[model samples]
Target: MPKIIRDLEKKIFNTSMELFLENGYEGVDMKMIAKKCSIAVGTLYNYYPNKKELYIAILNESWNDTFKRFDKLKTLQLTPREKVEKAILMLYEDIEKRRGLGKELLNKNIKDLIEDARVSEFKKALIKNMEMSISCLEKKEAYKDDNSINIRLAEILLVSIPILIESHRHEKEENIRFLNEMLDGFIL
Candidate 1:
């Protein structure tokens, strides 16, 4: 897309997230997003096609930003356990900042939308990041030598940690304590 269109999409996405958080998905409409973004409704449709598409775009953007953060964590020289801990903390901090919007977004049934090609690449990147983290943990002997358990644990943590953070947004201290205890069981 052209720079202008890309910029507009971002604006629309951010505006939609805020509106959805404040009012909820069913309460917000295309016109509301356009008004908040200071764009024509037609212009918004030019990029998104529909409200569901717009919502999915927001989710994809959020997921991509998160994956970028995880990518950055890999550059640090920390141990496998430390990498996982840091990644979890980063996710927690981010979710805490956007907890309301995130809760609203997560309330949507996005199973089919997330499987779309537009967002699938980010999903793959997330899986790759998890696999890399698990590999590092295995190398450091944080996990048993059994490949199956390592794979399962990696998949579980990759999917669960984010959901856990989002679910426990109101109980952050307790959630962090539980999360750290879970991590401690695997770390040496």
Candidate 2:
């Protein structure tokens, strides 16, 4: 039964992902997902309550692969600062690599609905990433006393990078250089 459930979930995910990519979030609905999966609306709702939940499930699955790469960064033997610089570059490159999905994340149409628990889970994962990345720097220096500061800094880096990318869209290398230069100020 568990196998059947997992298979059904995978089917739903695959169908919803294709539909979501072809149509924006608003363009797809629970009914459409159910139809695409050839399942009843109740069955779809049993797995995912609404369109937002469906979208979040799809996003969570997609991010699982990226999170693996993020995990691997921690195993590298570079200095704290170098790890951060690489993370910054990795973040930038990941955004570029998944530009379509990234755009959906910041898409205006779904902005209002993105403030849900599932979205919060995604945000928390990112914050944890930031904290891990920053903890390396904190260990080098004794100034890691404040938790809020680290949180804000993480928030800033994540939010600002996408905006920075937009303005420096023509020059990706310049963006990396600018981010690395900024990161240098954080190191002792």
Candidate 3:
């Protein structure tokens, strides 16, 4: 009789995500992931042909999860300011859950990971989401010298700020305060 493993794929996915975030792309391999997953190396290979393919799967799953949560926020009848604030707060909580692993991973962009088409689309989707969310702000004039929304500033705000925050060692409260101080200038 063939054995059935309940949620084996999910177990692999979660374990691989943690390992990748902790050790980064270059530092992790299928055998290591197999050990962590409590499965045979052959079994791991059967599920994913290579590390890059597994990494791409993990990336797609994780990104889709974030986007799904944020999509809920987007549907709420909230002001743009409220939407952005809530979104960042939720992201901050996600960062807190990743206390040990996520920050260091941000600095190392694996070449193979970046070269993947899905990763490229992920980057584009991120920027487009920021643009649309910022465009929702009612105080468009507040963002500009000439009363037009300065999208470049919004881009910097959305993309660079979180990376900057994660790069430093700071307490959660301090990070929140710092983010609020930075965002207050634009929202006014």
The TM-scores, one per candidate, come to 0.68, 0.68, 0.76
Q: Candidate 2 clash total? A: 0
lDDT of 2 by residue, 29-115 (tens): 888988888888989888887887787777777778767878999999998888888888888887655444545655546665566
- Give the per-residue lDDT of model 3 (tens digit) for 93-175: 65455543333224446667666677778766765665566666544354555444546545565554556456755665666
Minimum summed lDDT over a 10-residue window in model 1 is located at 99-108
Clash tally, candidates in order: 0, 0, 0
User: In candidate 3, where is summed lDDT lowest over 10 consecutive residues?
Assistant: 99-108
Error of 1 at 67 (Å): 2.6
Candidate 1: segments with Cα more than 4 A from true spot: 1-11, 23-28, 35-40, 100-112, 139-145, 162-173
Prediction 2 TM-score vs. true: 0.68
Q: What is the C-alpha RMSD of each candidate to the true structure, in Å?
A: 5.1, 5.2, 3.6
lDDT of 1 by residue, 1-188 (tens): 53354577667777788887678556788998888887788888888888767766676666667778888889999988788777667766765666544343233365544456755665556566766765665333645666665556555665565577667657776776677566566655
Q: Rank the candidate models, highest lDDT first.
A: 2, 3, 1
By summed lDDT, the worst window of 10 consecutive residues in model 2 runs over 138-147
